[model samples]
Each structure stands twice: as C-alpha cells, then as structure tokens.
Target: MLGELEMVKAVLSGSRRTVVLTGAGISVESGVPTFRGRDGSWKNYRPEDLARPDAFEARPELVWEFYNWRRESLRESEPNAAHLALAEMERKKNNFLLITQNVDGLHCRAGSRKIMEMHGSLWQIKCTKCTHAREDFSPLPPMPECPVCGHLLRPGVVWFGEPLIPGVLRVAIDEINKSDVFLAVETSSLAQPAASFYQLAKDHGAVTVEINREPTPISGFMDFALHGKASDILPELMAGLSE
Candidate 1:
C-alpha cells in the first residue's frame, strides 16, 4: 500500500484541475479564533449573536464594535505557511481555484489570484440603503456611513440568515464539477454547502483529500485523510508535487 503522503502526491501528479476548500481552522494558526470556539465571544455575546442581520438592524453600533475589533485584531495577522503553500500551488497549476469560508482576506494577501470568498470579507463594506460597496481596511468608527449615500454602512460579510453573495455558489459548484482533485483543508466539515463539496467532487470522479487537525464527520468519506496542522502538511504536500 502506498503511504499517505505518497498517495497524495500520486493524486496531484495526475491532476489537471484542482479545487481547494478551506475554513476557519486554516486561519487559527494566524491568531484568528474559530467562530464556535471559546475565544469567539466578546463582551458576553457570542459570534452567532453579533454576526446576524437582525443584530445589526437592532444595534448597529454593537455589531460594528464586534466587527471592528475583529478587523483590528486581524490587521496584524499574516498568512502562515499553509496559505503561502496554497498560493504556490495556484501558481504552479494551470487550472486552480481556492474557495474559502474565512473572511480575513489572508488568501489574497498570500497571492492566490483565483479565489472565492464564499462568506464575504472583513475589508469590504456596503451601504444599508443603497448599492454602494467598496473595500476599506481603515479603522472604522462606531457607526460608519456610506461615502456615496451617507446611510449606515455594514461589514460585507454574509450575516447569519442572509443568503451568500449571489453567484458564488454557482461558480464554486461549477469548479467542483470540473475538478480532477479536490482538497478540503482545515475545515470542520460541519457547515453546509462546503461540507458537501467533497461528496460532489467524488461523484464527479475527482480524487478527494482532507487535511485537518482533527477527525470530522466527512473524514471517512475522503480518499485520503491527512490529520495535522495545515501550516505543516500543505507545504510538504506542495513540495512533493515538484518532485
């Protein structure tokens, strides 16, 4: 039997089109807390409480407070080895796509050109009363207003109960369908849509791989399950592709 690393290398060696799906675990090494973890709370409120459209509608100031804190916290966080390795993978592959659930913009900072931020981004803001939206990394006030409409501005993230940014799902599914190899990295495999991507790739005849710190619900489904820190495993995997 081939070793796990050898098996992964063999799969990548034959792959032409690859799609990668990532979640919060990939960013945890960069000091970002997982949404369901103990550190996800602030001022006696959970992330679920603050990251909702209703919460922003009722107390915009409080919502902004939480997001602003998150933004400031992430401002200094740099992409780890895993992120850089993925960027290198993108550069090497002719057809590569990175779909991430994280909103921190670390993938972009790491130089991954083909990316889909399924959950939206912390650096983007939109007007509540108009169609104006733009990226702004500057520190925001308690109640930032739209430059175009003066209406209250909100973080560009897909708040709970809100639909994903239009067309992101369609494009992601299209890529998954065309993938020759699918890698789920640092994901818990609990969230919807993304949780099912591995199965979709399998159905489409793609090799499925999972790289995570712990076993998840879908670990048994992957063709190869590599359990470890993504910052360590990803660089090693990418290095094997060159040999």
Candidate 2:
C-alpha cells in the first residue's frame, strides 16, 4: 500500500500532466444521495426505464419531475472542501484537468477551471428540435416546443441510451492519454465508459490513484488507494501544496 501522504506529495511535485476523474462520492459530501446506497433510486427503480431517451420522450413530464427534484436538491447544497481542494490544485499547477460525471455544478462553483463534464449539466437545457440551449434555474411548465424553433425542450443531459457528447469525450480522452498522473475520486469504479478512462490513463504511462471509502473494481490496479472521504482527505493532502 502506498503511503497516502507520500502519494499526494508525488502528485504535487510530478512534472507530467495530471488528470482528475470525479464521481458521485464527491457530491455525496454536499448531501446529494448516491445512486447505489440504501436510498439510491437505482436499487428501487430501473435507471434504464427512467433515464433512457425513450422514457423522456414518452413522458417528458415524468422525466422533468425527477430532474427538477434533483435541481432543487442541488440548490440547497454547497460545494464541500474536496471540491475546493481541486480548485486549489488548479491554482497551484498548470497541467491539470478535472473530469466529472456529476450534473451538479459544484466544481465550477468551487472555482475549478478546465473541467470536462462527461454527463453534461443540470443547469443547461436545450430545444430537442432547434438546438437552442438555455440555462434556467427555476421550474418550468411543460415545454411543448422550442422558444425559437417550436421543438420540444429537453434536459441537457446524456440519457441512458444516448452517446456522450463527442467534444467532451474527445477532450477527456486526450487529457487522460496525455497525463502522467490520474486520480479517480469517490467513484464506484463500475460505471461504463467512465471507468474505462482510468485504464486509458494508465496505459499512457500515468500513475493512477483511487480515493474511495471502500474497494472498487479497479482497486487492485491503482497505484495508490487512499481510504477516506474526499472532503476530509483532499483538504489535508492539498494543504501544503499551495505553498
């Protein structure tokens, strides 16, 4: 087992590019319920039935209801110390990129620049017909058509059956391949393409680090396994790096 302190020290002092992959665990610190625990919706309801594009198309109202509830939940939460630590890392170094699976905008709010949101964002909405993008914070009535083109409005997220945004995926892949250090933070290590990102980073000769409370699928493959909550561990690890 690599010493957590020594691993972080090496990350701070390393010369190659650094890439960060964040997941639901980081948002858990901000009071957002993860999708895998006792209260996780995935255990009770099938995400494919709810998160698929077909579901949204057949019942936009239902889809919006879930998303709106999520939006409200996120509104009450604040960015935690772990998010701030990443921002601190950005300030201290020039070769870092933060890639997140969360729809919450906490990372951006915490001032982490160079972030690539793999799943898209809740703050953004778009017209299904005209590509009109809007960022609205309030609940909306059933949007029947695009304001500009009369097309049905939809959430700006990658649905269960949809492909990821090509531009964002391209950037993430490029960064992972270019990095000399890659950190997987608070992720389940089971999510599809996202889990694969860590392997890509490793294949590129980057040192891979996993920060989670428990062992995950890729635990054995990681160079360092830092066991703790990101909010508690990240701040402590980064405390001395800003100097």
lDDT of 1: 0.92
Candidate 1 residue 90 C-alpha distance from true site, Å: 0.1
TM-score, cand. 2: 0.93
The sequence of per-residue lDDT tens digits that candidate 1 reaches over residues 1-243 is 238978897788778999999999999999988977877689889999999999998998999999999999998899999999999999888899999999999999999989999999999999999999999988899999988889999999998898989999999999999999999999988888888999999999999999999889998999999999999888888875852
TM-score of each: 0.97, 0.93
In angstroms, give how far residue 115 of model 1 lies from its true place. Answer: 0.2
Best by lDDT: 1
Deviation in Å, model 2, residue 132 alpha carbon: 0.3
**Which number leads on TM-score?**
1
Candidate 1 residue pairs in clash (backbone atoms < 3 Å): none
